[model samples]
Target: MNLKTFLRGIHLREEKELAEKSAIRRVLPEGEMVYPLSQHIGAPAKPVVAPGDRVLMGQQIAEPDGMISAGICSSVSGTVKKIEPRMTVMGETRDAIVIENDGQYTPAEGFGAKRDYKSLSPDEIRTIIRDAGIVGMGGAGFPTAVKLTPKNPESIDTVIINGAECEPYLTSDHRLMLERPDELIEGLRVMLRLFPKAKGVIGIENNKPDAIKLLSEKLSGDPQISVQPLKTKYPQGGERMLIHAVTGRDIHSKMLPADAGCIVQNVATAIAVYQAVCCSTPLITRVMTVSGDGVNTPCNLEVYVGVSHQKVLEAAGGLNCEPEKLISGGPMMGTALYTLDVPVQKTSASILAFAHDPVAANPSTPCIHCGRCVSVCPVHLVPQMMQVAADFDDFERFEKLHGMECIECGCCTAACPAHRTLTQSFKYGKASVNRLRREAKAAAAKD
Candidate 1:
């Protein structure tokens, strides 16, 4: 098979053996569940239930506050304990809805009833997704409803399902694809009905040959949708790179996939869409990988959205020892988890507990101007130059260098001999630039 890929990416040890073969296991929470209101990328959800109110499993607990926000649903039947500030995976406190689990797992009215997608209209499908609180699920957590209804729906010619689970030690999506290929295809069909002219494309990294072959065979005899295998590489699943590899189209930071006549959805997100639209199941539970050498058992588990990290770790058979580091996602772009006291949100992907910290042991040295960082950059940005501009707080120079285009994939840092914090600096620089813009707008408004 001819493998497709984008330009300029580094290959690392996949390290997927830890949990790739483990089938997804469902784990119920032991105690109270905490649902953070701000699970998606936009505004935080607003609480619809008050304290002491009874809520059922799959019941809407929070509603979308802004046009860009996503609603929140309860994963288990319980009483609303309170709405208070709670610590999340980001290591910050945010308003969250807490529920005391009654252990009944009682479903709301009409939950889990199967429906025929052919009978539903495009608008009804979108509404079902929005109400179910479905988001990117790959990690971005962008609301799926808004992404499907882009500015020019007619112009979209390709709908890409991202089966490229490129991140190391993450296999939730892989398991989902292999276990439920037909459901995934059905989910794609739902989206395809929304755009009449668009053809569906499923992009999978060749490393997962089983998934690729399974999905390819499942999609056989179907002209509207096809499977495309991609060369395994770091950040191959990055929205821009994936778009380019599958469609041979390039989109910059300012352009959405819709602008390039494409729409990309994650593998797990597709399954969630299928369950939501066809089975009347909301986005309450999702499969996540809990792996790393520090854990007693590294396996993929279908965890509920509001389950506490402590509960998740316990379900993994507890830790083997004190981990040197804990990450909320995968190694490449995952966030450093300061504590296990936080609750899992819709955006949570993996919980990695490392026995040792490799990066910390390799102390940073000065840049040697080897230009290796530039060679590995998926977006082709100069990390050395961007680092200098960021160090000097030169936002203008950074902007000129297309700093915003950097996907923060950590390719530069991994490829760098000096072990410099390229991704971290770029994140800081971008935050500073955005802060300045906000300040300027505020000042202008006052004037």
Candidate 2:
């Protein structure tokens, strides 16, 4: 089989052996659960329950505040203790719902019973997904309902299911693909119902041959879907890269997958869609990987949405030693945590703890113009030039150079011999450009 791949991505040592073969285990919270309202990439959900109100497991505690937002559901049977600001994995405070677990584990009404998905119309399927509060489970956290209801649904020709599991040390998606291939396919079919002309493609990196074989064997004789193996590389699961690799379609920076006659969904998100449509289940629990050199035991766990990271660490058998760094997702793009008190959200995929410092203590030096950053950049952006523009506070030059096109994948930084923070500089440069644009717009409005 000829494995397809995008150009210009670095290959890192895949450290997924610790949890890749481990089956998903359940982790229940022993104390109060924290549900942050602004977990997804839109306006925060509006809290519908108040302090002291009883909420059953899978009950909606908050409703979508806007079209782009998703609803918030309780992952445990409990009473609303309070609704206030709480620290999150992003190292910022946001409004969160504190629920005191009653330990009953009672299921909410209209949940767990499987339904006939074939009888439901496309509109009905989309409605169920929206009400279930499903989002992109691959960590993007964009509302899935909005993604499914594209403006030109009929024009869509392909639906790509991302199963690459490209990030090192993260095997949650890998385990899901191996154990729940049926549900994943069913979810893809469910999405296909929304786009009648679209065929489904399951893209997996060649590193996971088991998943590829299982999905291929199960999908045999199915004309609408096929399994495509991708070359093993970091960020192979990126939306644009995956689309280009699988369909030979290029998604410009300002355009969406819909513009390319495609729609990409994560493997776990596809399963979530299947559950929401067939089981009437809400997006309350997710499978995540807990692994690193610092961990005493590395495993894939199915955890509730509001459980704390500290509890998860304990469930993973605590740390082998004092952790020098804690990250909320995979090391390449995941955020470093300031505190373990932050709760898991719907998009949480992995929690990594490292005993040895992941960063080098050596100070950054001047770029030697080796052009490694330019060579390895998946998006073809010049990280070195962007850094220079940012250092000079030249937002105009940064914007003109298309600094916003940077995906912040850290590949340039990883390939940098000078250990310069190329990705970080581009991030700051983009923020500065956006700020300047907003200021100019405000001034024009005032005029």
How well is each residue in 1-447 modelled by candidate 2, as lDDT tens digits? 889999999999999999998899998787799999999989999999999999999899999998899998899998999999999988889999999998888999988989988999999998899889999998899999999988999999999999998999999999999999999999999999999999999999999999999999999999999999999997899999999999998887799999999999999999999989998899999999999999999999999999999999899999899888899999999989878888999999999999876475656899999999999999988888889999899888888888988888899988999999888888888888888889999999999
Question: Which number leads on lDDT?
Answer: 1
Task: State how far residue 272 of model 2 sits from its true place (Å).
Answer: 0.7
Candidate 1 to truth, TM: 0.99
The TM-score values for the models, in the order shown, are 0.99, 0.99
Query: What C-alpha lDDT do the candidate models reach, one value each?
Result: 0.93, 0.92
Off by over 4 Å in 1: none
> Candidate 1's residue-wise lDDT over 1-447, tens digit each?
989999999898988898889998998886799999998999999999999999999999999888898999999998999999999999888999999999999999999999998899989999999999999999899999989999889999999999998999998999999888888999999999999999999999999999988988888889999999999998899999999999899999999999999999998898889999999999998888999999999999999989988899889999999999999988999999989989998888999999899888998899999999999999989999999999899999999998988889999999998999899999988998999999999999999
Off by over 4 Å in 2: none
TM-score of candidate 2 against the unseen true structure: 0.99
